[model samples]
Target: MTLPYGRDDDSAAYHYINAALRGRDAEAWRLLAADSHVEQTDRVLRAMLDRIAVARTHRTAERATARARAAAGEITQAEYQRDAAEDATKASKTAHFETLLREHHRQIAQAARRLRGDDVRDELTDLVLALGAAVDAHRSAVLAAGYEPTPADEALWARLGELDVPDTDEGRTSVEDLVRRHAERQDDLGRVLAGIILDVAGAATSVPRSALLTEWKKTVAPTLAPEQKTEFAAKGKGSLATERLRKTMGHLERKGLVKRSPDGQRLDLLDRAGLADVADGRE
Candidate 1:
């Protein structure tokens, strides 16, 4: 029989399911089941059934008593349904974690097989450490900005924890691919930030770094949080809003967004239209 979840391949179903389970929103669950793939639906249901079977096997006497009560209408159908749903959620988490564990083991084994010597192992270790450091830096920035991670973000971090560098050609190739992907994402973010800087540049030929920080806090910060303020004023290095903006402006300057004055004060905006276009999501 066709399962309800197999109805569509849209990612919305996954989000709906996460929201439904976390928030206990029955309507969201119903909507997700109605629109998602039948196969996906069956997987979850089967998982639930498998869990129940294991429980029954362990508690045969209790199961018998419960069955008798259920048959005699001592347990309402609504109550049974709720219990089953909870069992299914337990199964779902078990399966999710099991998959991640299996994948991690598989990757570790493959990496070891590919790099069969101490020298290879060391090289792989260095590469993996570099990748992990980059990811950690980004995570720190995200946290410093007071942003909360979603479930997907946490899952990604979990997967990254499993990364290993193998000495084989395939392993090196994978590392190279990851590096390229990281660069691309950084470039994209830089472009977006440059656009925002340009929008604030305005009629002034040059903007001071301090002014940029003030304008940014006033403009962009509100869109994210209600009582929006940057935590750039701490004690250490790069610990002020102006310092953060200065670093950002340096990146933009390299990207041709602005030019540094000869006296090393204020930035002269160049290619204003290009920055505005990126800001407006036009090009």
Candidate 2:
């Protein structure tokens, strides 16, 4: 009998059945059963029935194989029962983990909403702490199961330390304010770091200022709150505008206006040359 193995729809099955019948395949007609309501049966029903039948056949064959193995003394009944129980336990654990992951994502979404001030301040703090604990627990469980946490997860946990939840309401407010301030400071530091990286590493291989600016806007800006963004934007502009300052300093050092150590770590600023370079740049 020809089955609709590759057919995606009833039309395809109909074509296959017609072709089989035209080729005088009696088994195909018997499989189709003239009294069966093919019009009422959807392709999904047929596919599901086929799958169930295949599963049943597999179970029967497996049972027979197991019986033969037991007869040959290749496996014990106790061993087979133990293996079956282990498989069931593994499947249950997998299902439990899937549920936990779904809950985790749901909780994170709730925490994000709370972060946006959709919930009470105290409630938001509790939610954030709960979410963080859940994530840490999940990470520990996965690691225990021999799965390594991604670098991103590790980075997040490190950043969470900077979040430092406080007990008192005043302390919590202070912590939140500190987080905002630190984020701004980090952005300003990043600009300095990017400029320093360009200078010390040489400008030819460095990312363009425009690209760095775009990266800063996309990555560093949103890390701060909305109000903090306005405050930090001015600071960032000032820091970024000092890009030529490093190069000018290097030039002055070469001219004996500044004495830099071999490693460029310490700078002994020579007053005359430093003033001259600054004056020259201004001119």
Candidate 3:
């Protein structure tokens, strides 16, 4: 079977070339360096470009000649039309290949630059007084962006608390600490959610959705209290506790205390310590 060549083949070749360079393959690296004589790779590129230019000029002339011959009755119109159609097909294929090459050229340039890591540096001075202007700018940007932490984002941030690595304020209130604390500051229900999620954690990263709902009914159903059940009887059929659980989990997710598993049927507990802090009470 004849294997077709297309974008997949081109992409594989591009990746292979860049990976070879980044992996320090000596021969692949030579493309960037040249001997004192002639730049070998540059010459090869220029030669290919020159050939393409010549071919383009030839193609224009060839089409014009075919049209002229057909008009002068030197060749039959049907024959000329068939040849023209074939030429058009070839031209389209060539055009697509050229476009792919141009894209490869751009991405390869970027990949090469990143591979070199041209100007990395260590700390220039003792930044004991502050994190320096650049670090300060980044922190300010994070603040300015008005980031609203979602459950996934919060989960990641909460997990970072394990590091307890503070960047600002000199070893106090690591960003992760602030995130865990945010859980406490929200509402009474959030602490309640934290306790429930903590109870669900085990060898598994998460528990099924049904597991959480069942647990919710046991923990917070108004029927548990005589007065509570009577008050909610006319409230409607929707489970207020379940709605609260959804909102509470949403809050927990942002706190990074828990996350929904990719299947979304289970909720994963991310930062156990953060959840512990919440469940112990700050409400």
Tens digit of lDDT per residue, candidate 1, span 1-283?
3323434543544444444445755454444334233334333433433444466456556556666777889998777667667766866876665444333323333333334453455566667756665666666677889999878767656555455445334544344445555455445555656655665666766677566667765654444321111111111233343443555566567657688778766678787876676566564
Residue range with the least summed lDDT across 10 consecutive positions in model 3: 118-127
Q: How would you encode candidate 2's per-residue C-alpha lDDT over 195-248 as one tens digit per residue? A: 443443342332343444444445444454433322222223333323333444
lDDT of each: 0.53, 0.47, 0.56
Itemize residue pairs with steric clashes in candidate 2: none
Candidate 3 TM-score to native: 0.31
lDDT top scorer = 3
lDDT of 3 by residue, 55-165 (tens): 877998999999999999999999999999999998897777555443433333333323443212112112321233233334456557997656665554444444444
Clashes of each: 7, 0, 4
TM-score, one value per model: 0.31, 0.18, 0.31
lDDT for 250 in candidate 2 is: 50
- The RMSD of every model to the true structure, in order and in angstroms, is 22.1, 25.1, 23.3
Candidates 1 and 2: which is better by lDDT? 1
